[model samples]
Target: MNFSGKIEYWEQSTNGTWSLFAVNPSDNFSVYNFCGKFGSCNLNDNKLPCKCLPGFMPHVPQKWYSGDFSDGCTKNLMSCGDTFLNLKMMNIGRKPEQSHQVGNETECKELCLKNCDCSYTYDEKSCLIWTQELVNLQEEYVEGYNLSIRVAISDIEPTVQNCEPCGTNMIPYPLSTSSNCGDPMYFSFNCNTTSGQVSFKALGGTYRVASIYQNTSKFFIQVMDVGSLRLNQSLPFNLTTPRNSSSNVSSRVTDDVEIVWEPPLEPLCNLPADCKD
Candidate 1:
């Protein structure tokens, strides 16, 4: 019988239970890459079942909006200091072209990072890496492996040139323009060479940098007189400390608020006076 333009056959087993299955052209979701590469199929989403993965944008917005995801999604060109966007609870379809046995997640990540061809990595029982475009990605009811996809740093946030001293305030570690300058993870600060002004990037707008105190692990950001700043009360655009650092970050608002960012003290104490035994 045909229902909703779909041909189906009801087959009864010996137990007297009948199963209805599609005969001719089945549902679009039944086929792999139904939503195209770098796209995911959401069975729960009736209105728009297809969406690009995080760190990706629809290749063709016009076609994507028209219920055609054939063009799929695309990512920006990545550089050496690129970071990963962790996609959790993913169905990550297809066998990995490259696989390896690793001791831990860090080892797994390092292996993928070394190879420019490695686009994504998964470290479950072992390390799994993929070089080609990801396809047939699905999000089932249950949780799945965590997949780390390499993405450009600029895509994650707004970046500016590294500043030793912007205007009057000194920029510290982990706040550089390029991968070679400082820890790229903390490259969230922007330096304006023309005006000699440094700004802290926020979701809504940029905040003028006031001062940085390495001893107290704090920095200050003031609202720019002519700029817009939309701050989230919950997060308030806090700087994330590097993973290896042992400092516990804390922030508070004052008439002039100071933010905390502490890296390993050894690097800062290299000067003769500071390093005196």
Candidate 2:
């Protein structure tokens, strides 16, 4: 049972989402003390199976042993700056079969440095952004796609990589609540605090929405009646957030989100924190 190996599980990056299982036995993966615990690894693996990103390091090392590496690594003792990129299970041997073989790893960095719009780079593919925001960042194995994050110059050795945040896509949103039905009806929204991109869906059915507000990374709504809620004629719509690793979109409202749903009123207002009706 000493089967071990690092498998590429591209959950978010490219390919929509393809799950790859680690612990390859036929592939010659060896046995290690604790492997594949961080991502999807096995107990027996030769390489550094589980590891934190550049800006991050091991959190609870003991928990990491059992594979509970959720609280991966904390930010390194360096401020946000530039640092040489670090390459892991990349070009050396792994890559997406459906990926476009652009070039070598060096070429990847060359591309990132070439475009000012490029917010972040990974998988040997440069995410050339016409706009800002590098959202939806996930980890996986790809040929020639080792990513060295833009850490504080203090993180890496003097001769290593260097980088800094463009500070463009870090948007913010505020929450708010309003009341309508004679102190009984309430409305509120919270921006989804997810990076890169996100899809927003209205909770209730058709309701008369009066506003689709946006504040920093928060979404505000001033709907009228509880008949039909929509971004426009569309009930239960979706709002895809930006594609930045550090982006959040939440629905906000005033103390009691001022909601004027038509027809049958609503239930969210039942909570005392929401309304008094």
Candidate 3:
């Protein structure tokens, strides 16, 4: 059932072995610390986890001593002049209620500065600032992204909530990733969610992103290319794996995502008859 190296072919007439190796491995560069999970804690738990962000002090250090990081390593929310200090390449975190991404260190700071709700950052790539209490904090496993939350600044970005992307010459992509329906291309955000951010009702539709929003109120969605999307139509599409193909996805959205299709796996691209003209 398994190959030894590279899979050359799969034929019913003959049995052959196939093996695979990953050319790009992120595992070689992983750094984990319990303090990062504590949010306030540094690398070692030995130090007091109650330390506040730079330019601020703890609201109640005694409570944090009792394993209550929920006190949120308090900071001076009233501070006006405080800006972000970029810890280069440091691993920051993603907020559950907030949406953001990593951009240039200066842009990350500016992004937070634009919004009074945004305050600080811990890393250049994975920046983290705080306006509210930093709770349920955990060490982010994926290549962390940076975000300056808020200290006390006016709206930074051109958008109202500082929600729109701040930097990147070609338009920075959102971390909320998914594949483009019908095209088999992965998409993070397009015209849809951008519209939704302004008006909650604008985006929830037959599109896969809307499909997820309809079921889960959490509002985290990225339409993937795992299904055939019938434009302007609402119909249940079944995802099936080919006879021996490992790619497959279940129709039920709640179940694990099926690896419905692969690019090279499909027959060599022959244009649909209508496109030939």
Candidate 4:
């Protein structure tokens, strides 16, 4: 017997009547990066299935508004800097170009920063780094992994201003935890009262904030040992300060985290012979 449609499978019953057997629904979503770079496809959304990531605007708004998402998105020019935005519970649909087993989350961030092409970093059991334009990012509401995209500090919305200082170092507007201090967008940071050190919290782990530069919008954090991976922490939530007020916080040697520096956007030479000219 012939089936009416390609997706429906029919099998003959014992009595001789043919009935529906199984359906292969793979046709619904067979294309990868169907929404293009920086565009997230929402299977739940039928009317407008594609959306741009936070801090991103459609590369061609006209095309996006017209329901053509091939152009994807582009970073806001005014928002260029060295901070990061945490997109939790997401399906990054593509495998990273580089994967390494690092000591902790900070090392992953540092590794990505060292590569100018690196766009984002994901740390679970291993540190995963992606380079160039990212594509096929989907929001998996349930049982999804955490992703941190490199963004400018200005890209994050400001809630608290003139935050209280974290010891000798000052806590900038978007990196503070005190209500008096800010990224209502879930920029989680912790200030240690006893040790007087400020820490930045991420899915991979936590790291110490070495310094913050307001003029250039840059941050230097020190990577710590990976004791725990806080995978269960809810997204868009603040990390409460440690209750213990003692000064016995153990000190460990950490590598310096420099995420602001980047390589030249364009190659210096097209070929080896071009260098001679």
Best by lDDT: 1
Question: TM-score for all predictions?
Answer: 0.48, 0.27, 0.29, 0.48
- Compared with the true structure, what per-residue lDDT tens digits does model 1 show for residues 1-277? 4755656778898999999854654556766687888787645333346767544678899999898888888874545444775555566667788888888888888888886646555556488888778887775425655567776645443223323444223455556544444455566677665443467766667665655554566666643232244444443235432122121211222223345654632333444643332
lDDT of 2 by residue, 82-145 (tens): 3443433321212221222355655654545443323234443434211132221232233323
What is the C-alpha lDDT profile of model 4 across 1-277, one tens digit per residue? Answer: 2363447678898899998886654333335676778776644332235666655678999998797788888876543456665665567677788888888888888887876445555556488888878876665445555667776544444322445544324455444567543434324668775444567677777776555555555555555443442423444332232222211122353333443322212223445743442
Worst-scoring 10-residue span by lDDT in model 2: 165-174
List residue ranges in candidate 2 displaced over 4 A: 1-44, 88-119, 122-144, 158-277
Whole-model lDDT, candidate 2?
A: 0.32
Among the numbered candidates, top TM-score falls to 1
Model 1 is weakest, by summed lDDT over 10 consecutive residues, at: 245-254
Which regions of candidate 4 deviate over 4 angstroms?
1-30, 44-47, 78-80, 120-125, 141-143, 158-277
User: What are the per-residue Cα lDDT tens digits for candidate 3 across 130-176?
Assistant: 55444333222235333344433221221121123211101111112
lDDT of 2 at 112: 50
Error of 2 at 269 (Å): 72
Better of 1 and 4 by TM-score: 1
What CA RMSD would candidate 3 show?
20.6
Model 3 is weakest, by summed lDDT over 10 consecutive residues, at 166-175
